[model samples]
Target: MPASLALSPTPAPARGRLWRTLRQWWAVLLFGAVAAVYALSPSSHDARSRNATARLLHATSWQALPWFALLSALISLALIRTLVVTAQSYGLSQFALEMVVRVLLLELVPLGAALFLLLRVALAGDLLPQADPAGGLAPHALAAERWRLELLPRVLALGFAVLALATASGVLALLLAYTVVYGVTPWGLDSYTRMVGRVFDPAVCLALGLKTGLFAVAVAVVPLASALQEPYAAARRAAGFAVRSGTRRVLAVLVLLQAASLALKFL
Candidate 1:
């Protein structure tokens, strides 16, 4: 009896191990999907791609305006004040406004918006399903339609959210920086516009726009892909791993953006 029992093939353990392995690959698959989208982005002239681009812009800008404005204003005030004080201390006040535009507007705001959306929207998606007792769809179906429609859309929305916030904040910060430096006066407009025009050359503008779009896509696509790649049996074990995988995906996207921007600038 003991021999017969021992000889019995326990399929459960084998199945569990297979599930675990698949869960691990889910993260990898998510990263690949984001990369693929970037590579296969609809042509600039393609009507469908154009519409998608327009939708992304509208969603990010109009839908996310209020929250973005509030956050951007708070951050701008803190940064401007610090820059003003620091510049005065060093007798480098002349350079302060330029620095604010270059640092806060050009670099930080966009990245911050992306990160904020990742936390606010992307993380929430992960936690929401877990919190729902009757919440989750069956694993296979969830992997198919749900991921493409529900998860991808939210992620895409987040990308838009970040882009809209960044563009609005960058513009606002420019206005605020001028007021802080030159006071409320019409004379400053010419100088401000010149600086804006110089800073926003055609290439730089294109790069910035592309970067914002990419950031949005990265924030949305990676996490959902990770979750879907896992085997059904390992769903519970896969959750934490999937989040981590998503984070890595975000980081990779950021790095690639920076590299691309640099290459564009130099080349």
Candidate 2:
């Protein structure tokens, strides 16, 4: 009787674990499919593709627009002010705007947006829900639903969000720099536009877009992958382990993307 009772629960746990594994794997496969389609599709003007793109753009832009714009503006202003003061201190005030654009827009904005999404959307909502004790679903079902509904949208959204924020913030930074340098006049627009047109060559634009997309994927996909890799029973305890693993994965992706972008630029 005692042996049978012990063995009974063992089967249930095993069954639960197998189902959970299947669900996790399915999620990974789905993610791969989505990513492939996204990458391979040409820039399209056809209604279907355009609508899909617009939907993605809208979701990413509209969902977080107000907050992201505000944050970017504040950060840009603070950084510009600091750079201006530093440059003035060194008697190089003329170089401040150029420095701000190159550093803040070309580099920091996309990376910051990626990290922000990872924290706000990916970590706080997506992963946390997967580990929720009272979610009231079985482990496998919960994992599947989380991946399908939460993770997929987040990965897609973050990718688009980063792009939107980068483009929007880049323009804003340029404008802010102009106002600082030229004191709110149209006189600087021609020079500023020329600089932008020169900087945004085909290669640089492509690289920027690719890097932003990869960052989004890294932010959204890695954490879920890590969480899925954990044992269902130990999920809560394993959350930290998963997070560390995900961080490493995200870093690897970032380094590889950066290296690839640099290599492409040079070659």
Best by TM-score: 1
Compared with the true structure, all predictions reach lDDT values of: 0.65, 0.65
* Model 2 lDDT, residue 130, Cα: 53
Per-model C-alpha RMSD? 8.6, 9.7
TM-score of 1: 0.65
Per residue, candidate 1 scores C-alpha lDDT tens digits across 1-267 of 588787747688898998865664464454446434543544322554445545655654565678768887888988988998798899997777777787786677778878776666445543222312332233333333333434434445555577667777887888788888889899988877887788778877777787777777776566555555545566686666757766776777777886777687679
Task: Report lDDT (Cα) of residue 188, candidate 1.
Answer: 85
Minimum summed lDDT over a 10-residue window in model 1 is located at 127-136
Where does candidate 1 stray beyond 4 Å?
1-65, 126-148, 236-238, 259-267
TM-score per candidate, chains pooled: 0.65, 0.65
